[model samples]
Target: MDQIKARTIEIFLPTGDSKEVSQAIITNESIKIIYISKSEIENQKKRISKIQGCYILVGKDDDGSDLAYIGQTEDFFQRLNLHKKEKEFWDGVYVIQNSSDSFDQAHLNFLEKLMIQEAKKVKNYKLENVKDGNNFSISESKENECYLYFSTIKTLLKTLGFDLFVPNVEEFEINEENKFYFKEKNNNFSGEAIFENDKLIVLKNSIVSNEENVKDNYIQYLKFRNKLINEGVIQKNNENLIFIKDYPFNSPSVAAGVISLKSKNGWEVWKNIEGESLDKKYRQK
Candidate 1:
């Protein structure tokens, strides 16, 4: 296995406030990241207006789900100014550029397309752009450079507390010890989940109870379940609901609740192949 070397990242807060507009850069790297709020656009125009780069607009939908728009432009300030007046959903934007101003339109286009493709794969945000960017041809060397540039963008974005590009379930080695199961014979609900990074991921194609079987009015599981249905994360198949893709929940109980459609002690309900409860396998040790 190749060893991953540590790199230094420096974040500079222009307004002396962490929440305000900030710039980030990795040591000896040409790539730069600037996070600017919509409200701060006018103030930042003089600094970033002429930079040719790719940007991501981030905000929330009417349902409060995470929403985003990705694009590339030669004039950062002008493009964002247009977005400010035309698009009402984005609250903030992340501008990615090179310090040397070497990125051409073709580079930006390739980066925009790659970012959109990866964001769609992550499915973490609702994309505001209806269509993907044009797949323009680029040399193999430039394509590799764009991919490396995107890797830094993804890292810096997450460091800035924006995970629009982060995969919900990162690819890693899997084993029996990391897997858990939930089955309800009466309701025909059977789910397969894995506990990874302290998160419980309900795998795709897992069957869930279509009906809300809980009597507690305070439980918000039903609302979340409905949101998933509306988002097409889960859909009805015959008499039961099935996950359209792997979804991660903060805790095992929440994952169980969404699957069973009732309040459940996930630690007690989720079991391994040996019928060992999550509580016994993890908590007890």
Candidate 2:
């Protein structure tokens, strides 16, 4: 096929609705056409099947018939979404479920083996990082992602051992309570929050360098503090910035974040267990 050949695709959403869109197909008269939906490559469920899980998609590609793509999933829909988002090149794939199918743990293991077999038979992207969180890797990085299009994936598989456990775009859960000192990175970091005793703490800070001394508080932080104040977390002064109950407070960075959102001070934004900034807390100490 010509590299410049025009391509077309009909995208089906999770809702089962679809839209036809333009795409590309690297084709040459020498290479036969192979079509398989990534979703079809995983498990599906029926209304009556007591067992629930995904199945390995079994079908044929250009190489030959019965060349299956085996994969396991609790929610086929979730896995299907992953395939669609990561790869948008499956063509001529008729969207239909296999009739009368039920998936169980044994089925899952068998499906995995089948997928592994298929991986060995054909040049395909290895589902790397699946263990960490369903990460399927076809290439190395962003650079490799660009180079290893669907065609390149097959070629790479032919050259390298089949392994698809690539780290995917996902967030890991780090559960631990620690006091964090925030600095300006404009990076909205998210993690679990734990409330200990009377004070609230974040799980571990994932990014940035710190042992969790004190955090540069935001308005949200202040609001949380304010709630505590109403509930007696700290006592407030009649000043513009609230004060702790005579304990010294820690200030935010020199350039406070969310200045535009609301006028705040590095000094008053932060507080201690005693609810005082370093300025006043030191005196009390």
Candidate 3:
């Protein structure tokens, strides 16, 4: 839960300026994680086809929800080639491997299971694999080793900007005194928010106004409303719309707009326990 320690990450850009087609390597670690876009994979087929390990297909669904599928194989790039033909969703992949080339089938199997479980728990991404992937067993020592490798892989993945795992609030900052609250005068809409870094997270079980009364002109907002319901972030029960889990919004206004079912200045709407508006807090800063 402590701050992420400073670590060295080496990225090899094959095409010089193409981030979508690069290999990210962390030295003195067990696994190699490569990121490549579908468009660039064909050119690097020979290079990737030679290596084998666990990989995750990363993409976004039509509802704008993140999606991922985790798998392990003896021939990594070959399987990806098949996915290119059969699966059409993923735009990129994070191919994980043992730098020492010591990871056997058991090691990759264990990593795949753990990865699937963690992805499901986060609920931030929609996993493509519906049923549980292979649930094979491994040796006790190998299990521990794979777990340590998995931790390393997570750190590397986060460093690359794909934060599939969400850490607890305490791990980032410790500002509990200035908890922000928002409420609407016309409806029974209310919510609590806390800051982590520059991003604000509206707490779970927060209440929002039902969209039935929202004007038909706000088509985008209505679509967003349906997306939230589909994602299980918002629940419509007893004629009320409520946040079932903590949701992060880019800014105070964005968060306020979602709950109010209309455009609102979040800085003016969110206030502290002492009734100090977010605008006032910003001026203080």
The alpha-carbon RMSD values of the candidates against the true structure, listed in the order shown, are: 2.3, 19.4, 2.6
Task: State how far residue 65 of model 3 sits from its true place (Å).
Answer: 2.4
Using all chains and alpha carbons, the TM-scores for the candidates as numbered come to 0.91, 0.21, 0.91
Better of 1 and 2 by TM-score: 1
- Sorting all predicted structures by lDDT, with the top scorer first, yields 1, 3, 2
The window of 10 residues in a row where model 3 has the poorest summed lDDT is 167-176
**4-81 per-residue lDDT for model 2 (tens digits):** 644332222332422221111233211111223443333322321232343333333342322333455555555555
Cα miss at 72, model 2 (Å)? Answer: 1.9
lDDT of 3 at 279: 81
lDDT to native, each model: 0.86, 0.32, 0.79
Summarize candidate 3's per-residue lDDT along 1-285 as a digit string, tens digits.
Answer: 444665677888778754667677776666778888887788877768878799989998876688888898888778988999988889998888787899888887888888889877777778889766776878999999988888888877887778776643535443557689888567778888886666678877788877566676555566676688888888976878888777788788778877777777788888888888888876577
Q: Which is the leading candidate under lDDT?
A: 1
TM-score result, candidate 2: 0.21
Worst window of 10 by summed lDDT in candidate 1: 210-219
